[model samples]
Target: MEATETVLCSLLAVDLTDYCYRVCSRCQRVLPSDNNGLASSSFCNFCKSKEPKLLYRILMSIATDTSVKTVICFDRAATVLFGCSADEFFHFTKLNPLAASMVNQVFDGEMLRMTLTRPHNRNAQHMRVTSIVPLRSGFQPAIVTLTHICTKNASLGNCSTTNHTLRKGRAVVLDDPNEETQTALVADPNQEKSQKKGMILPFKPLTMTFHNVNYYVDMPKEMRSQGVPETRLQLLSNVSGVFSPGVLTALVGSSGAGKTTLMDVLAGRKTGGYTEGDIRISGHPNEQTFARISGYVEQNDIHSPQVTVEESLWFSASLCLPKEISKEQKKVGMDEFYLIWLRYG
Candidate 1:
């Protein structure tokens, strides 16, 4: 039977073998690998792109008290458990054989609230884990815990396969035989500090003004039959407002007030209503660009239930940020917003 469920369960075991798969960055389809386990082509057959980047698709078999389920955790949920992206996790495991075992130890018997979905197809084997939240407070991700263990073992002369060093707040992996070193910086603490210092993304701020705004909808048949002679019912009349940048504006009104109607007209969000008004942005008449610059939040908003907050921010940054900004800058901007949200929200 197809079903979706939320359960409070403890992780009994986790299988780390074959934990990740490679997919085309453009189309997100599985890419075939060669004999050396490298992507066969730089071009994606599905998207027809010449320079196709690769991303990691993380999968795991997790056992709970009820049953053992193989689930596709995807990127966001997997990142929460690993404290790093799937690509970084794969690289760490390749450099050190004990990394996977250490991760298992870190996650074993952890309490979690999981949203699981079963496919409608009876032949499908794996259930999809839409979301994962650690039930315990002060939860540490696997990578951080493993890094600590590895560092401790190295200092005590117990680690033999690889050497660990901390350089510039990053974990550096040194191969013993050739003395070759690979450094992976999970996150920059200094950058986070700077974000906490109130760094904001650059944008051209504008002021919005609406004068003598009016909104109306067609009078219902029942209302017309009740001896109402008007052809249209007015929801808002003579609503005037000026909203400036960097200012918090409140629309204080009780039930049946025209606050929502005025906002809908100003934001060009009223779908079936007729609006008559002079709505200007920065003293200019409202244009198509107004929709791009302004946003309206409805009383009730809908979002994908499966997406985590981090994932939502990433998606919004990738899609809504200016195209001129580089990807790295966009990432930094997204992080700054995330920090602000956590602090105030």
Candidate 2:
């Protein structure tokens, strides 16, 4: 007999989850070999014996296909990406809104694409994520390729993570999607919009401000503390923008014009520690209060070897999202179509 790889959609869970549904009328009653096989099962001797293995297989398949980075059993994963680590991040953060959303689609026959900025340790940093839901449920990824969208090196990693220089073609890794989620998967009507185009951000501002920002060109403390003058810290520059939300704003200039400094300031990097100006987020331009909603993607990222495009997006989605959203809502949000353009920090 030929090796059997059950077409996932054609199979239904023996469990009483929504993953099992009636077959289309055109199909036969006994689990159709194609699109019409969802049904509840009353296990006999064979079913009872095979249940464990079958469920395991399904879960493994889900894990393999989910393709996200930094699967958080808790909120620690979120902190790791934000430079806040577990203890601090968990205290005051919500679930990563974007990653949580894509998890459903990945199981609902959606394939995602991820563009990571400043990738390292196979993590997607400052990422642009999108998804493509298949017309039929439980299909393979429609389009998959992970790229980059960034301005430049945005921040410094902790000592443990910095010594390692990033090499190209490293594979990103993440926890497998849960069986429970896959069992309850549902396709989104808006998936078409997200899949055909670029990534979606739940809340991004139109005009951003940078005030009292400072910058300097010096090697990290470890490398330059000796003999290197601390005074090399020059006031790189100060800048502010009236960038319209959902529109691209480009900062173009020569090598030494402080473009990196400007991108960092707008992103709330080292500069966030110093400045005060109102960044108008959507219509809620409190400048002072709502600025944390911004995203800062760098030029490189942590992409694992053999990680599919969709997996990369999932990783970014998880890290970028806010905690307030529910799992189902996240699925719908990430499924919408978008347009992504690259930035140079």
Would you estimate the TM-scores of all the predictions? Answer: 0.38, 0.23
Q: Candidate 2 residues 269-289, lDDT tens each? A: 653334444333321334434
lDDT of 1 by residue, 197-287 (tens): 5534434445566667889999999999999999999999877766644457688976579777787778777789788877766445787
User: Which residue runs of candidate 2 sit more than 4 Å off their true CA positions?
Assistant: 1-205, 211-232, 271-292, 301-345
Q: Least lDDT summed over 10 consecutive residues: which range in candidate 2? A: 142-151
Lowest lDDT sum, 10 consecutive residues, model 1, at 170-179
Which ranges in model 1 have alpha carbons more than 4 Å from their true place? Answer: 1-3, 19-22, 31-53, 118-124, 160-345
True lDDT of residue 51, candidate 2? 26
